[model samples]
Target: MGHHRAHVSQGHERGGGQTHEEHSGSHGHGGHDGHRGHDGHAEVFRRLFWVSLVLAVPVVALSPMFADLLGYTVPRFPGASWVPPVLGSVVYAYGGRPFLTGAVQEARARKPGMMLLVALAITVAFAASWATTLGLTATLDFWWELALLVVIMLLGHWLEMRALGAASGALDALAALLPDTAERLTDEGSEQVPLDALRADDVVLVRAGGRVPADGVVVDGSAHVDESMISGESRPLRRAAGDRVVGGTVATDSTLRVRVTAVGSDTALAGIQKLVADAQASGSRAQALADRAAAFLFWFALVAGVLTFGVWAALGDMPDAVERTVTVLVIACPHALGLAIPLVIAISTERAARAGVLVKSRLALERMRTVDTVLFDKTGTLTSGRLTLVGRAAVAGLDDDELLALAAAVEADSEHPVARAVVAAHAGDTPAATDFRSLPGRGVRAVVGGREVHVGGPALLAELGLEVPSELGEAVTHGQQNAASVLHVVRDGAVVGVLAVADAVRPESRAAVDALHAHGVRVAMVTGDAQHVAQAVAHELGIDEVFAEVLPADKDAKVVELRERGRRVAMAGDGVNDAPALTRADVGIAIGAGTDVAIESAGVVLASDDPRGVVSVIVLSKASYRKMWQNLVWAAGYNLIAVPLAAGVLAWAGFVLSPAVGAVMMSASTVVVALNAQLLRRVDLDPGTVTGRAADSPSR
Candidate 1:
C-alpha cells in the first residue's frame, strides 16, 4: 500500500503542464532552473575566490610582517588590533555570502546542509574577532584562517562545477547528434524551422547521411538508419516505407522522406532526457537519515557556541571563553557532512544516465547495490517478444528449405500473425505470389510460380482431408509444449510440411542471466503464459524460480511476497501488465523499447531495451553508495579530530588550534568530500552480459 501510494504520487498523471522556456542548449544541471542556480553559485564563488585572495594578502601584511620588514615600530591606531578583524570581515562578507544565504535558507527549511555549516563557522569567527578587536579580551586571532577558508572553499566549488560539466559528455554527444534546424515541407518547397517547432504529422525530408529530426515514420523513401543512440546496435538498420525512425539516429544512406509522428517532449530523444532527469531527482529513506544528521548539526553548533562563550565568561577567562565559543561554532557546521552523500549520488546518477540506464530514485539506486533477487517478464524483457520461425519439418520428398519456401509463398497474402511470421522468416528469399486470397481466421491461398498454394493451421489442412505425417504430428506436439504456433504448408492439394515459430529469448540472455547470479542476485521468471511454456523459458535461461500464468494484480502480490521475505527485489519488464508489479517492487526497471510503461511505472529505464542494463544500474548503484560512504567517513573523521583540537584539548601539549586554523581545516575537509564524490564518474558499470535464447531476436 505504501508503495502504491508512492507510485501514485510520483506518476505523471498531473498532466504535462510543461511550460517551455527558451533554454539555449543547457547541459545536465538536472533542469533549467537547477542549471541557473548552479551558474549563479559558480559566479558567486568565482567572485569570492578572487576577493578572498586579495584579502589574504592584506591579512598577512597587517600581521607583524610590515613591522618586521621595515624594522620600524609603527604606532598602533586607536583600536589598532582591530585591523585584522576589519579586513577579515571584508573577506567573510564578500567571499562567504553565498554560503551564508544558503545556510539561512536551509535553516528556514529546518535542514542544514554544507552551506549552513560553512556559514555558521565563518560567521562565528568573524563575530568573535570583531569583539576582540573592540578591546574585549579575546584569547586568539582568526584573521588569516578565515580569509584562507573562504579562498579554499571558493576554489573547491569552482573545481566541483567543472567536474560536473566534464562528466556530462553524454548529453553533449546527444545534442551534437541532432540537427538544430529541420527542413519542414511547406507550400513553397521546404522551410527551415527549429526542430522543436516541427509538430506531429509534419513532413520533413531528411537528406542522405542526415540525422533523423524527430520520431517519425518513413513516408516515401527507404534508408539505413544508425540507431545506436536508441537501440545500442552498432550497425545501422534497414528502414523502408512505413517503418518508424527515432530522432538523433543518423541516416547512413539514401535520402528519406519521413512524416513526424512524435515531436517536442513526445520524441524518443526527449523521453530519454526526461528519464535521465527523473533518475537524478530520485531519493531513498537512507538519504533522509543523512539529511536529518546535517539538520541536527546546525542546531548543535549554534547551541554549543553560545554555551562555550557563557561558561568562559563566568570563569573570568573572558577572552579564552570567547575564543572557545568561536572555535565551537566554526567546527560544528558539517560542511563536509553536507556534501558527503549528495555529491557522490549526483556523480553516480549522471554516470549511469550516460550509459543509457536512467535511475529513477535514490532508494532504487541504493537497492541496486544490494539486491538479492531480480524478477524479469518474459516478453520484451528477456525475449524479443516477436514470433519467428525457429523449426521446420519436410514431407517425404520436400527438403527443409523447400518447405520454408512453400510455407512463405502460401502465407504471402495473409494478415494473421502466423502468416506474418512465415513472411518475416523468408522475407528476402522468396518473391511474394500474385492473385492472393485471404480467408479470415482460416487460411490464405495464393498463386506462386503459376501454381496454387494454401497455408494455415492444422484445421485448414484438415478441411482438405490431407494426410498428416507422423513426424509432423510429433513436431506439432513439441511445439505446443513450448507455446509455438504450427503452420502447415499445402500445395497442389497435399500437406507438404510444417513451420514452428515461437516468441524466443534474446541471444544475449544466457550470459546476462549468469552474470546476475555471479553478482549474488538470484534471477526469477514471471510471465502470463502457461506453466509448461514458462518452465521451458526458465530452464533455458537457468532461472532460479518461475511464476507463470500470473494476472496483472497477482504480479503485484508476488513482488510484495518477495519483499516480505527480507529481499530487495528488482522487477524488470516493459509491458503495461508489469506496471503494477514494477511499482510494487523495491526497484522497478523498465526497458527503453517499452516507452509507455517505461514512463509510467519503472524507476530505472534502460534506453537500449537490454536486460544487461539491469546489471549496469546495479553496478553503478553499488559503486555510488561505496563512494558516498567513503566520503562521509572521511568528512566525519576530519570533524571528530578537528573539534577536539579547536576546543584546546591539546593546549597543554603546546598544540593550540587557532580560530583561523580551525576555519581553514573545516574548508579543506569540504573540498576533500566533494573531490572524493567526483571519483564516482570513473566507476565501470557495463551491463556485461545480455542473456537470451535463439528462438527470436530481442526487441529493437
Candidate 2:
C-alpha cells in the first residue's frame, strides 16, 4: 500500500499536476506517507549494499576454493567452526536489516510481505549453523549462500531504486525550472531579489532569454516568447505592451518591462506543478490492488516457509529441513514481485515522455487501455482554437479577391482577434486608415481611401437601413448552416459582399477520430460552443455523439455519465476550465498548451497542438499493457515451476534438480521478464497509422 502511494505521489508531482483540484484529488485518493516509506526503503537499501558487499568477502575467503587455490592445509582453531556462524549473523543483522524492519512494520499493521520471507530465510540459516557449532549435530556452512542471497537482493533493490529515482527526478527538475529570483525595477535601476519577496503591482524588468519570474502584464517593451513549457504549444508568442506573460515561460530574443500581477505559489506554473505532484502522490484503485497483492504474497510465502520447516523437521532431518526452509525463504523473496509492476510503470512512463506525453497520474495510463469512448473538447482538441476564413460570397459586381482586400482594409485598424486574422489573410502591408468605428458585436465602419466602408455581421447592414438581395440572404444562411460567422461588407450603406469565418476543424483531427473508430472506439465531442457550432464540427468528423455548450462545472458529469453507461471514456481537452472533467475520465489527455489546471488535470500532454497525440497514447497504452501482462505471466509461471523443481518434486521420477541448476533457472526467468518488458520500446505507434484510414475519409 505504501509502495503504491509512494509511486503515485512521485508520478503525479513529477508528471506535472500542481493545482488545487489535483492536490485535493490526490489527498482524497491517498496520503503522502507512502512516499515517506519509500524514502526509508531506499536508505535501508544503500546501507545494505555496503554491508552485503563486505560480508561477501568473508564468505569467499571461508569457501573451500580458498584452501584449494592456495595449495595449503590450515589448522582449525578451537571452535573456529563458529566463525562462519558469527559472520552469518552479522550479515543478517546488517545486510538484511531492512527486511527485518519491514517485516516488523508489516506485522504491526496486521499485514506481511516479501520482507518476512527474506528475514525468515536468513534467520533460519544462521540459527541452524549456530546450533551445529554448539555440538548438537554435524555442522554445515550455509553462511556463503546467505551472504550471496542478501547481496543479490541488495543489488536488485538498488537497481529498482535507481529506476524509480530516474522516473521521478525528471518531474522535480521541471518544477525546479521556475526561477527563484526576479529583477525588480525601481526609480534608479533594477535589483535582483527573491521571487517570493515580489508583490503584486511591483514593476519588473525581464531581459532577453530570461524566464518570466512571476505572472505579470507587460507595460513598456515587446518581445517574442517561447511558452511551450506552460502552454504545450511550440509556437513563439509575440508579447507586446499590455499583453500578459505567464511565469516560467522563456523570453526569446526580446526584453520586456512588466508589472507583476501574481507572485509566489499563486503563479500559474506553480499551481500546475503542485497539482501534478498531488495527483501523482494520491492513491487510486490500481494502487490499492497492487498493495493487496503484495500483502497477500507476503503472508502466503511466510506461512508456506514456516510450515515447510515444521513439516521437514518433524521427519528428523534438521539440516535438510533447514535447507528447505532457507530455499523457501530465498525463492519466495518479494524483490521480483515488488519490482514487477513498478518497472512496467516506469518504462512506460519514460516512453510516453519521449513521445511528448507527460503523464500526471499512474491510473490514467492503465485505464487508457480499456477506454471505449473518447470525449473531445471541441475548441482546442478538435478544432484549431483559432477562427479561419472558410468561404466567400460575391457581391453583384465584385470578385472574391477584390471583396477580401476591401474588407481587410476596413477592419485593419481593429484590435479584435477576428479582425487581426482578416487583415493577416490579405497577405500584404497596407497604409493606415483615417476613420474607424468598432461596432460592439458587429463589424467596424471606416473610411478606406475616402470610400465609405463597413465590415460586420449581417445585422450591421440591416441596422444601417440597407437592403440585400435574396441571393445574398441565401448565401448568409448557407454560411451559418456550415458553422461559419457571416461578415457582411457594406459600402455606401448597402450590402456588397460577405466573408464567412469559423473555428475550423484541425487538418488531422477528423482523421484521428476516424482512426479511433476503426479501432472500435466511439468518438464524442464535448464543447462550450453553441449547439450549431458543436453539431457542425461533429457532423464533419462523423462523431458518434455531441455534448454542446456545457459549462466547466458539468464537464465531469459527462464523463461519469458515459462510465455509468458502461463506456470507458477518455476525455481530451485544453483550458483551465476542463480540469475537473479531465480528472474524472478514464484517461485525461490535454491538448496543445494552457494553464496549470489543463496540464495537471490530464494524464497525458501532447506537446504539439494536434489530436493525433491522443491516438498515440491509446495505442501505446494498449501495447505497454500487453507487454506487462506477458512479463507478469512469465515471471509468475517460472517461479511456479522452479519452486517445485527446487524442492525435489521430480527426484523420484529420476529428474532431480540441483540447487545450482534451480538458481540458474530463476536467474534466467528474471532476465526473460526484463527483456520482455524492454520489448515495449520497439512497438510502432506511427503517426500516420494514428491519423486515419483512407477508406474512412475519402474526401481527405
TM per model? Answer: 0.80, 0.75
Candidates in order have lDDT scores of 0.67, 0.65
Candidate 2 per-residue C-alpha lDDT over 204-246 given as tens digits, one digit per residue, 9 for 90 to 100: 8889998888888889888998765554344567787666788
Going through the candidates in order, what is the number of backbone clashes in each?
Answer: 14, 20
TM-score of 2: 0.75
lDDT of 1: 0.67
TM-score of the candidate numbered 1? 0.80
**For every candidate, C-alpha RMSD to the true structure in Å:** 7.8, 9.0
Instruction: Please write out the lDDT profile of model 1 over residues 1-700, one tens digit for every residue.
Output: 1111111111111111100111111111223233234444456556768878987776755654334444656456786555667778888888887677666665675655556777777776677666556656545456666676677766766554443333234654675678999999988899989987898889999999898888888888788887755654445767776567888888899989889988766766666665654554444554565566666666766666676677668878767876787787767766677567656665776677656676656677887777889998777677766566878888788888877887787666655545666777774578568888775445677888887887766557667788667868887677666556666778888777777777766766776687788788999887776676677778877899998777657888888888898888999887466788988888888874423423668777776666877877777877777887887778777776777666666767999766655665777788778877877767655443222222133422
User: Least lDDT summed over 10 consecutive residues: which range in candidate 2?
Assistant: 7-16
Candidate 2 residue-wise lDDT at 16: 14
